[model samples]
Target chain A: MTGKDDVATLEEELPLVELPLDAWHRAKGARMVGFAGYHMPIQYEGIMAEHAWTREHAGLFDVSHMGQLGFSGEGVDEALEVLLPSDIKGLKPFRQRYSMLLDEEGGILDDLMVSRLGDGAFDGAEIYMVVNGATKYDDIGWMIEHLPDEVVMNHMDEQALLALQGPEAGDAMAALVPGTAELLFMQSGLFTWRGVPLWISRSGYTGEDGFEISVPADSVQLLADALCALPQVKPVGLGARDSLRLEAGLPLYGHDLDSRVSTIGADLGFAIQKRRREEGGFIGHARVLKELADGPGTKRVGLTIEGRLPAREGAQIYSGANLVGEVTSGGFAPTVGAPIAMGWVSLPHAALGTALEIEVRGKRIGATVAPMPFVPHRYRRAKS
Target chain B: MSRYFTDEHEWIDVAGEIATVGITDYAQEQLGDIVFVELPAEGAVFEKGDDAAVVESVKAASDVYAPISGEVVEANGALEDEPALVNSDPEEDGWFFKLRVADASELDGLMDEAAYKKFVASL
Candidate 1:
C-alpha cells in the first residue's frame, strides 16, 4: 500500500511552487491547507459565508497555483491533437475550448482549457493550454515526451492567476480595465490595467460571467488588491470555490474525474469533437469511442435533497431501499437556498427527475435527480 | 453559579439537581460555522460522556457529549432552524439542554472556569 512515507518521499523529491498571494492569505487569518500540491486557504471568513457571497456577488479567488503553460511553433494544432480528443484545427484564435487530457485507457487525467492565441488568426506559433494544478507536473512531463520536437512548451510559472466571479463580476472588472465588458465569454486578450499587463479571459468555473486574469507575479498583489477594493468584490477562499463548482455542476479533478472513471461515464462526452470521434487518433480513443457508442453503464447526475439538511460526499445513494450509487459531491447550495448534490448512478437512474434517496447519518433522506447548472449560466455570448 | 468544563469541551453550570449544558467558546471557533444542531429528545436518559447531541458545521460534524450523567429535561429546539445562535450566544441562549443531575458529586470531577481556561491554554 502507498503510505504517508511514500508520499513524503515523493514530495521531498518534487519541487513546490508558491503563489504570489501566499503571504497575503496568511495575513488574512486563513486556515491554510494543502491542496493540489500547494498550500491554499480553505476558509477565511468561513466556508458557508464565502460560498453564499460568491453566488450572489463577485468573489476574488487566488487560483495562481493552477498550471498555466503555452505551446508554440509549427503544426501546434496537429501536435496538440495527438494528445487531446478536441479538434484543434477548427479552433479560432482568442477563443478558449474546454478539453481533457486523457490517459491510454480513455480515463481523463485532467480537464483543461485550450486557447489558440495570436491576433485573430491561427498562426503556427499559436499558444495551446492550461492543465489542472494537481496533474500539471505529470502532464508537462508526458507532453514533453510525446510532443513533436518542433513544438516547444513553455510553463508560465512567472504568471499569477486570479478569478473574479459572480453576477456582478463583469461590471467590477470592467471598472478597472476600460472596454473589458466588450470581451465575450471564452475570449481572451492582452490588456494593461493600472500599469499591470494582464491576459484576461471572460470565463470562470462558478457558472457566472467573469474574468480569469493572468498577470506577472510581482503585479498580482496590486491587481488583486485593486479588484478587492470594488464594492461587489471580496476575497474568497478554496472552500467557497468547491461549493460553487459543486452547485455549478462542474466535476472536481480527483473526486469526480479520476483514472478509474471515463469521460463518457462522467457526462463529458461533449468535449470530444465529432471529427475526432470519427478519425480516432488521440490516446484511449478506441475505448472512449466504444464507450460513447455503446453508452456508459453508469453516469453522473445531480441530486436535490428534500430539505435544508445536506448529504455529504461518500453518502450512499439509494433507489428505494436498494443501493444504486454514491454521492461524489454534495452540499448546501447557497444560491438555490437548498441542499444539492452530484453522484454516479446506474444509467437507468441517471436521468433528470428520477427520485433517489441519500443516506445521511444512517437515515435515508428524500432526493431527486435534477438537471445541473442548478443556477442558469450567465456567460456573455457574442452578439449575433 | 459555579461553571465546570468536561474534557470534551462541554461546559456545565451545576446548581443542586439541575445542570445547564453548552459547548465551550473555543469549540465553536474550531467548528467554524454551525449549520445544524440535533438535540437529544427531552427526558432522555444519558450517562456521563454519552453522545447526547450533534452539531453540524460546514466542514464537519461533531457529537456533543453529556458532561455528567443525567436525564435531559430540556433541549434547545430553537437550534433546529438557527444553529448560528451557538456562535452568537453559546453560553446563554445557545445552551444545548438542561439535565436533571443523577449524581451531584459528578461536578467535582470537572474543571472550574479558571481551570478550564488553563486546560484549554495547555492544548
Candidate 2:
C-alpha cells in the first residue's frame, strides 16, 4: 500500500504468483491484492485498527516475498565487499548490517541486510543477506555476473521470512523462544522450534523492538499459527506494515529508494562505514566519495502537512510556484494523528523547518520540512 | 424518499428535487478505513459522470463521481472531523453532499435498491 503510486505498473500482464500462506491468509479473511508479482494480503480486519494494534502490541508479518540469499565458498566476503558499500570484510559473525547494491555508475541497485553467519550455519551459508522482493531478481543477476566463480550464491527460494514487531514483540518472543531475549539490536542467531530450524535476527523495518525469523516455506503455516496464538501477537498484513515503517521514517525500496537515488541523497550515508569510505573499493564508490566531499544535489527529508489531507507519492512539491521536488512516500500516519511524508528536495529547500507546498487535487497544501522518525523509534539496544 | 444506487456504488435518496448522496456500504468496505473525505463546495454545479468528491482511505484515494447532473445544495461537513461515519453508517450519517436534482429522469438509468442488491451479487 506504500507504493500504490507504482502499483499500476505492477498489474501488467505478468501473471500473479500465490504466497506460501495464501490459504492461511484467505482463511483469516485477509483482503488479497497483487503486489510484487504475488497475491499478498493487504489487510485483515481494517488498516487503521491493525496499525494501532502493532504500535500497542506484537504484530506478525509475513514478509516471505523478500529474497533470502545465502553465500559461501572462497573469498565470499571480498566478493560482496566489491558490490556493496558497507564494510563487509569487517562484519562479525552473528552480526547484521544494512547495506545497498549499486550499479557501476554508483546508482543504487537495491538496499539489503548483510549478515555474517557461524560455521556451517543456515544451510551452510557463510554470508546471509535479504533483499527487497520487487528488485530481487535483478540483484541476484547483478551479483552472479560480478562475483568470483569460486564464491557460490544460493537463492533460498523455499524459505519464508516472518517479522514479529512492536514493543511487546520481545516479551512475546521470550515466551516462545527463551534465548531470544538476549539478542541486542542488529544481532542474530540460529534456533530450533518444534523441530524446525530457524535463522532469527533482532531487527525489523519498523523502528520497534522486533525479530525477523527465517523458516522453511513448508513449515511457515505452523510457525504463523503458533505466533498468532499468543495473546500479544496478532496476524498483521502489509497495510499495517506500510504505515508502521512510514511513521518510523524507513523507506520502502521501490518507492522511496530507487536506482536514480544515491545513498547520500537518500540520507543513508551511515550505511557506508568509515572503513569502507576510506578504502573506496566497492561499486559506486566514486559517487559515494564525490557526494561525501560535495554534498548530494538533492536530499531526502521528512515533511509535516498543516491539515488532514494526505499527500501521496508522485505529488509534486513546490516553493511558491517553483517545482522543487516530489513526494516519494506519504500517508496519514495513525500514530501521529496527522499526515507525514518523505520526499527528495534540493539541498537549499530540504533544510528543517523550511516552508513548502504539495499539490493534492490541484490545490497546494501548506507543509514544513521536519525532523523524523515522525514517531520516536523505540528500538531496544544493549545496555552500555 | 426513494433510494437509487448507481453502478459506481453511489446512493441517492431522492425527496422532491433535493437528494442526499453517499457511497454504498460495499464501496466504503472496499476502500478500507476511511481517513479523509474531500467534499465539493455547496452550490457547485456538476454534469452527470463529472468528477465530484474524493474518498480517501488508508489504502487509496478513490473518486466518488457525480452519478447524475445536479447543483450542490449542501455538503455534509461532519465528515471533515469524523470520516469513519462513512464506514459505520455510509447510508445515513455518512452522506457526502446534497444535490438539487438537475433531472429526475436520470434516476431511470440507475438501479433501485432491489436491482442494486442483485447487481452486487453478479459482481
Candidate 3:
C-alpha cells in the first residue's frame, strides 16, 4: 500500500525486548522472530540442514531467555518441596532432576529443571532452577507468595545460558575447557575458561548427548564466538530445537502442558518420586494422588501420521466417528523422515498401536498411536 | 509461450490451450526446505483463486492458489518422495500441475516477468 499504511502497522506492533546475543545472531544471518517477549532466532541456514548438523556434530543454542534462579538460606530444599512434586530434599550435590511447579488442583504451572549445587557453583547457592521464559515472571510471583520469608530467591537476570548439544559436544567442550568432559548425565560443576567462571551441566532438552553452560551476561558474546570457532560447533535456531525435542518425546510448556493439565496425564509421573507420593505435603499432592488412584481422563500420546500433510496444533483427532483428541504439536521430523505429532487423547484411545485419524484442512489422514521417542536418545550416562 | 505470475506467487506457462503451473522461484525461496507437496488430483476442476495444492516446509504449510480458471489434466508425481525439488528447481522441473484452459481471458490480469520482478522488489 502507501507509506502511511506501513507506519500504521508499525504503530500497532509491540516492542520486543532484545536478548544479549541479538546483534550477534543478526550478524550471522539468522531469521529473527518475536518469541516470549524477546527477539530470538528462528533459523540460521535452514531448519532441515541445521537439524542434521546438530545430530551429527554439535549445535550451539542461545537460551538466555529462559529463567535462571538461585535459591539459598534456611530450609530451601523443604520450601521447594512444598511447591514441586520432586524429591528436592534428597537431591544430592552436583545432581539435577526434572521437576514441575503444580497448582493446588495438581495442574502444571511450569515444567523446570532443578539442580542441587555444592560449594563449586554460583557462590554456594544451595539450589538452582531453570524455568520456561514465557512463564518465568508468573512463576516467580507465585513462589514469592508461597515461600517463607527466610529462604531467599535470586533471579539471575545477569546470566546468559547456552546449550552445546549433539554427539560430539563433549569433544568440543574438552578442547576448550580441560577435564570438563568427565561429568556424566545430569551432573554439574563450576569450571573456568579464560578466567570467567561457568556453571555447566551435562544435560539438555535434545535427546542427544550435550551440555548446558551458564555464563555471565557480559562474557556471553566472547564465549559464543569461541565455541563457534571450533569446527564441531555450529549455531542452531528455535526451529530445529523444537523438532529435535519432539523427536526426543519431550513436552513443551504452554503447548503440551498448561495450567489446565495434570502432571499424571502428561505421563510425567516419574518426576514424582515414591517418597514425595507417600508423604503428600506438596500443593498438588491431592490431585496427584487422586489421579494415581483413579485415572486422568485424558493422556498425552505420540502419533505417526500416514500422509504428507502435517497435523498442526489444535487439529482434531478422530477414532471412527467420535472426536477423541487434539494435536498439540506436529511437524515433519528430519530425523524420523516422516510426519510425527504429540496429542492429548482420551484414555481409551491413548494406548499404543491404536488406530486413529487426524483431521487436517477438513481431510482425515490415517494416524496411529505410537511409542514416544520417535528417535532414540544418546545421552552419555555413567556406568553402574 | 510466455510465463505469467499472480500476486499469490503461482506461475503459469501458457502454450496453446495447455498450461503448466508451479510456484515462482521467489516463492520457493521464502518457503525453505519443503518437506511435502500436496497436489490436486487429475481431472479436478477449479476456478481461479481456489486452493490447488499445499507445500509444506519444516515449520509451516502454505497453500498454492490457482492463477486462472482451468481443469486439471495432470499432477506432479515426483513431489511426493522428493519435495525438496521444489526448493531446488521450482521454476522448471518442479512444476505442480497441468491445467486445460477454461477461460483464456483470465490471463489478462496476470503479471509478466518484468512486472513480477518489480512487484517482488517493492515487497
Top of the candidates by TM-score: 2
Residue A25 deviation, candidate 1, in Å?
Answer: 1.8
Error of 2 at A305 (Å): 0.7
Residues A44-94 of candidate 3: C-alpha lDDT, one tens digit per residue: 999898999999999999999999999998999899999899999899998
- Pairs that clash in candidate 3: none
Better of 1 and 3 by DockQ: 3
- For candidate 2, what is the TM-score? 0.98
Candidate 1: DockQ? 0.28
Q: Can you rank all candidates by TM-score, best first?
A: 2, 3, 1
Error of 3 at A372 (Å): 1.6
Residue by residue across A1-384, what tens digits does model 1's lDDT show?
A: 011111122233345556789998888778776677777777889887888788788999999888888888777888899889888988887778899888898888889998877652222338747788888988999889889999888888888899999888988999999768888998887788877778888898988889998888999888888888899998888878887888789998867788777889999888888999899889879878788789887888889999767787788999887889998887777678777888999888988899989998778899999999788888889878
lDDT head-to-head 1 vs 3, winner: 3
- Candidate 2 overall lDDT versus native: 0.90
Q: Model 2: C-alpha RMSD to truth? A: 1.7
Q: What is the TM-score of chain B alone in each candidate?
A: 0.96, 0.98, 0.98
Off by over 4 Å in 1: A1-18, A119-125, B42-50, B102-106, B118-123
Name the candidate that leads on DockQ: 2
